[model samples]
Target chain A: MIEVKKLRKSFDGRTVLHDIDATFYTGKTNLIIGQSGSGKTVLVKSLVGLLRPDKGEILFDGRNLLTMTSQEVKELRKEIGMLFQGSALFDSETVLGNVMFPLTMFTSMSRAEMLDRAMFCIERVNLKGAENKYPSEISGGMQKRVAIARAIALNPKYLFCDEPNSGLDPKTSIVIDELLSDITHEYGITTVINTHDMNSVLGIGENIIFINKGHREWVGDMSQIYTTSNEALNDFVFATRLFQDVRAYVAKHGKI
Target chain B: MILTNSLANFGRYCMFLTRTFSIPDRWSVFGKRTIQEVSKLGIDSIPLVIIISLFIGAVCTIQMQLNVSSPLIPSYSVGLATREIILLEFSNSILCLILAGKVGSNIASEIGTMRVTEQIDALEIMGVNSANYLTLPKIVAFVFFMPVLSVLCMGTAFIGGWCVAAFTDIIPVSRYVYGLQTMFTEWYVWYGLIKSLVFAFLIASISSYCGYYVKGGALQVGKASTDAVVSSSIFILLFDVILTKLLLQ
Candidate 1:
């Protein structure tokens, strides 16, 4: 489990996140959701040590991530895997090679073992036959799969995905989301996903934290989200046409 | 405004330097980047350098034949002049220009694309020292490969001049070899090699830095590429002047 307390951040004197606190439970998809520039990305990045918080303690299973030494941080990183929004696969490497990168850097495994592990991860992501293909030769969805394959290749204890559905079609987005959820349940990894996709929030957000203008607006599950009468949450949920229709339907039936 | 910003920039750079240097494994990362940079900058640049060196030698010889009417200044001096100029300026300075146009642009574009796409961020998240992994190898490769390319450029230019002199009847074959042997200096060759090494470092580092710091998207990458090449070229020329004045004296 990951716990953050009073997390705060600023860029050039402009505060982006303020006194935010949340917990991400293991074996479930913990989502940080907000609109653009709402500090969701910054908060998640801080949690992952990508960005340093001006104030707060991020305890990963009780180890304070903020105060860890560089060596300790590297060790901590080995327990974590990240899937970037843009599917940050190394353009120069083939699918298999990209998947094998983290292993090569951090492991004593032989080349054959590395290849075998990479193949297993690739197949796990349903990218079985595309091992030799470079990232440029593949579609965006395929690239995201490759990124996922690489992220999981290390068998990390913590999985962090930043907008995994960005640039993907609705169908592909659902596939990606389901895959992440399934992986989280299967591996029992503490998974934190930063997303704005309402579909993702409703479909797989078992533990959700909503950020608005850099502050934690609400924290709840999908079941509690629609019932919450918070104005900001209502505004965000109803802003979408599909959710608006759903809200109206519930209202007409007096079920909301 | 300028002064405050400049000071702020300096502080930022110092912070970056401290952060990068604090890591013990950065040397290994540097070694990796050096190899990549060498392959991109040195190996890929062979064709252009060869083609340009040959033409430059030929042109110098032709110009010598046209301008010199004094029999006292031997026709073989054409080859000698080509050798001297190629070693002193053409190979070191001209090749820097070529690299600023070619390799510099490549470094900037690649790094800029990586930055925009968040590949660099991915590296950081993985606890990779992005600067050392990305920049060090290129610097090392430039330091090693630039000198080798300088020698190749000098040799090719001399051959090109020899070819022109022989074909145009400006200098006989035997006299061209004699002039080359007489004019050759270990110090001059070393001086040129040293210059090439400096040029390589400046070009690769500045270009890579530009790309690494790029923001936004495709347009930003393009702008970084342009800026890298322009800055590298200007710095190369400026360094060349300073090194020439110091080393030659």
Candidate 2:
């Protein structure tokens, strides 16, 4: 589990996230949802240590991640995994090579063992036939799966994915979402996914935090989301006509 | 204010460099990376360097022959002049300048692309010291391979000059060979090699630094690549002056 207390981050005197606090539980998909430039990216980046919060306490299993020494930080990071928005597979390496990278870096596994483990991960992601292909040769959805395979290669206790479903079709997005949800439950990992996709929020978002202008506005699960009366959250969530119609129907019916 | 910013950037770069050369997590991994970098930065660069060096040597001989037109001067001086220029400047500084374009920009673009794409972040989150894993291998590779490249460059240039001298009849082959033998001090070889080593480090270090800290998207990556090549060339020239003063004096 990860606990963030009073987190704040700013760039060039313009504050991005302030007074943000949330708890991401193990074995659940926690989603941070907001519009573009709404500070969700900054917040997630801070959580992952890519950006340093101006003031905050990020407790990973009750240890302050903000104050750890360099060596300790690296050791702490071994239990952490991140899937970038673009999937971020090394362009030079094949799918198998990309998934095998973390193991090659952090493990004492022999070459044969490493290959076996990498093969297992590729198969687990349902990418068995695409092992030898480069990331460029695969679809965006497949790249995300490769990224997921690489992320879980170490069996990390914590997983962070940034915009996991962006640029993917609806069908592929659902597949990726289900994969992430399944993996979170299967591995019992504290998984935090940052996204603005309302579909993702309604689908796999077991716990959700809505940020508007660096402030946390509403916090709850998908089930509560459809029924929430928070005006700003409603504005952002139901901005589209289709979602607004769903909201009206749900309101009339009293459930989604 | 600009001075202050520049100084701050320099400090940050120095700190990054310190982190880049730290002890590896696994020597086997590092060794493998080092060998790959060596092949890319050194072995792969051989043909281009050879072609450039040969052409440069040929031109140097012809230019010396044209300018030293006085019958009073020995034909051997043409060979001597070509030898001196090739060894001192052409082989080390010129070749490095050329490679600043070839290899430096490559390092910058690659690292910059990775940064923009979040590959570096992926490495950091994995607990891999990204700097050490990525840049150190290239640095070590350049330091070790550059002297070998300098030797090859110098050898090719000298032979090219010899070929020009023999074919063009600017100087007889026997006389040109005699001129090469006349005052062939060993220290010049060492001097060219020392310069190559320093230039190699600067190229790899500056280029990698630019790439690693790149911001924004593809445009920024391209900007970083340009900055790397430009910075590397400027530093190579500046160091040439400083090293020339300190070493030769």
Prediction 2 TM-score vs. true: 0.97
Off by over 4 Å in 1: A253-256, B1-37
Model 2 chain A weakest 10-residue run by lDDT: A41-50
Share of native C-alpha contacts between chains A and B (below 8 angstroms) recovered by candidate 1: 0.75
Name the 10 consecutive residues with the lowest summed lDDT in model 1 chain A. A242-251
Clash pairs, candidate 2, are none
Candidate 2 off by > 4 Å: A246-256
With a 3 Å backbone cut-off (N, CA, C), the pairs that clash in candidate 1 are B33-B137, B33-B138, B34-B137, B34-B138
* TM-score for chain B of all predictions: 0.90, 0.98
Best by lDDT: 2
In the range A1-256, model 1's lDDT, one tens digit per residue, is: 9999999999999999999999999999999998899998899889989899999999999999999998899899988999999899999899998999888777888889999999999998999999999999999999998998889888899999999999999999999999999999999999999999988999999999999999999999999997898999889877898778877898799875
Candidate 1 Cα deviation (angstroms), residue B130: 1.2
